[model samples]
Target: MALDKHSDTFSLQRRNQNGSTAPLTNWGFRNETDPLTDVLLGSPAHLFHRATSSLSRKHLREAPCNIQVAQAQHAELVSTYKHFNVNVHMLEPEPELTMQVYSRDSSVMTPYGAFITAMSQWWRRGENYAAIRAYEKLGIPIYDMVTAGTFEGGDFNVIEEGCVLIGCGDARTNEPGARQVAGWFEAEGWEVRLAFIDEYYVHIDLMVVPIAEKLTAVCLACTEPGIVEWLEAKGHEIIDVPFPQTMALGCNLMSLGNDKVIAPTSSTYLIDQLRARGFEVAAVETAEISKTGGGIHCMAQALRRGD
Candidate 1:
């Protein structure tokens, strides 16, 4: 069950005239589609709002306390995103996910395109539909969906050009989902790795992220041991995400290609660590945005890359 070595993928999100989310794939256009390099990563419109959990009823009475800070953090995030040369895309807030939306977590970006996911968390299911609509508008082809397993975009990280990693735990993306991803990539002649961890590390990108070609930012404290060894085997130089900064999302760095990245304010150690490792790092204030267990890498999904 292997695909040809040279096949690619397509995305399913679409766009209206205003660059907003368009739920219809009616256009059916494929050629001349914009690449991920042309798209900019964007932040979710609301604050303290989470789009991927079953905590729908839990936030009714208890509200988020850092709304103001979250807004400021989002604005700073927007500014930071521009420095990366991204064309930001936004999703209109829907109450189905309790208004806490991590738009980037809605789907996984692949070499071919974006693959829609079946969220194991009930509150996050609607996010898939929202993302699908956006991809459809963007004219990205759809690789497929997580038919047998529950998958989330946050659990997926394209560690390298030919290697992909899938993390399963906390009911985000499960075992079946990881296997499915492996199967798909293997079919395409790509290496796939699965890291099954606790709910605390829900997404692989939360702890480990690629800053450049072979460099990664990791929090050894929570990062699984075997994966660490495997990375070393693959020739990856790991920059440990400081425990204190990791808690504040220092590990959540986003690669703007090359050796450049965007990190949050609280992770000073990460800033110094990345800088020492030869990365051009830009630090932003994200105290408000991190409350939902996501950061720079989590907020934006790279739709396409020059592979």
Candidate 2:
């Protein structure tokens, strides 16, 4: 249904309370790789390096992020999106929300509407509210808010049109949160699978992400064998990314569909593989900014993917 943008009673909950919610006509997507037309990104103007995760803490302790360079890199990422003819929307910058640059952590755009996620970290919780306001401004109704427990958008991975793979790392996304989300989708007749991962990995997107329909990128060393088997059973072609590169967010990429992808320059392995497959790859340097804890996929929220 089209949203009445001027209405004061603009519904915030677009999802059905009992399931069978109709997909939004103007916004949201059925899957990750579907010719992305609109995307949501957060501003890095106020980004700051923080001990958000084990990887981030390690980077902070070893070599602090150069904020200026990170900001510059983010600009390049935005430019890359523009080059692909994707409409980019930015969330208003808030100084206190230093890690806001990772837009995928706050909300997930689903077929029904936007799912406002509950952040795990105390400092990041405010991002949920920020995300709500941003969606309101964009005329996108919310599906629902994660209330059972803390859940981040990175854990909500849509494997296909009516299927999703949720991740529970206990740190960023807990079992309760994962179960709550899984139940919602299950009731909606979606094939939902929960992947319990180690906290060190932070989120499942780091090790497993969809590149295109029936094609996925995975780090076999870190992902559970069952998950790998599950993908294979569904006829998904897995491109294994080495453990070392996976840790550097090599598996984390945004597929623009129609054989196009936006990847991190650090992910040389994945980029090379995609290029070899005749996919147009736009490699942007994100190593400096990633020290704050996220890759290309984590930094962008797909607003509208299929037509």
Candidate 3:
């Protein structure tokens, strides 16, 4: 069954001191594993596009996607979200923007609001505007916009309410942008962990994902040793996803609260690991979509995490 276009049912309402409804400043996400009540899934209308970066070229191998199959895969994702009782919203498609389907790269959701990213790739820069429009439509306030340097939302992962891990590598999220965002978190008394990864890894999310409270999936081979150690020391259960599977985006899974997750079908190892650890796994075949340079986590951006 086709999912209906996103309704206003998920719109948040909060009362100000004056007894009038106002948008909450802390409306977005504080933790990735909280009850995922709302999310923004990117549109797949222009998914088939020319490769803009090495990651895209490597994953796509310069091959074209089967548009029909890609759309079908995306629908499965939406269906899974609905089945899990998650409110799904779609980014209004921009026919001219080919890479707009990866909504996670355009902006990041924070406890305060959404921070729009400064896209590194010229071809993907237009996606920021599309994301801003979508957020406005959803009544999600814009917390801040990145202006210091290039940054993508894929590099951010919230560990808990007061702790976050940000990836900093010149290839995607440069130091300036990472520092700017870090400052905001620090001012709020949050501990910000910086993971400096190799350029080969497009984002930290490609190597790390929080599956549940005190549990995380990590590509140990690629993720920095210090970062892994810090997580372990923080009492997180480390589920190590091997290099081969990680390269296929096995670590790029989304936590849908209640110990459930949505992952790519091809991520057999990670899916099995998650299930073995008692997580409900909702798998979708994203072969065609992944070829466009991202996996499930990279395709959807969390909007509201809790009730």
Candidate 3 per-residue C-alpha lDDT over 12-98 given as tens digits, one digit per residue, 9 for 90 to 100 = 222111222222444576689988998998888877655655666775575766788889988888899999998898898987788
Query: lDDT per residue, candidate 1, 137-203, as tens digits?
Result: 6756666677887887778777776677778884677888788767776766667888987775667
Residue-level lDDT of model 2, residues 1-307, one tens digit each, is: 8854333233677667689887777787889999999999999999989999999999999999999999999999999999989999999999999889999999998878888999999888888889999998887888888899989999999998899999999999999989998999998999999999999999999999999999999999999999999999999999999999999999999999999999989888888988999999999999999999999999999999864
Ranking by TM-score: 2, 3, 1
lDDT of 2 at 27: 83
Clashing pairs for predicted structure model 2, backbone only:
none
Best by lDDT: 2
Single out the weakest 10-residue window by summed lDDT for candidate 1: 26-35
Best of the two (1, 2) by lDDT? 2
Off by over 4 Å in 1: 1-36, 39-43, 48-64, 98-101
> Cα deviation in Å at residue 207, candidate 1?
1.3
TM-score of every candidate relative to the true structure: 0.81, 0.96, 0.89
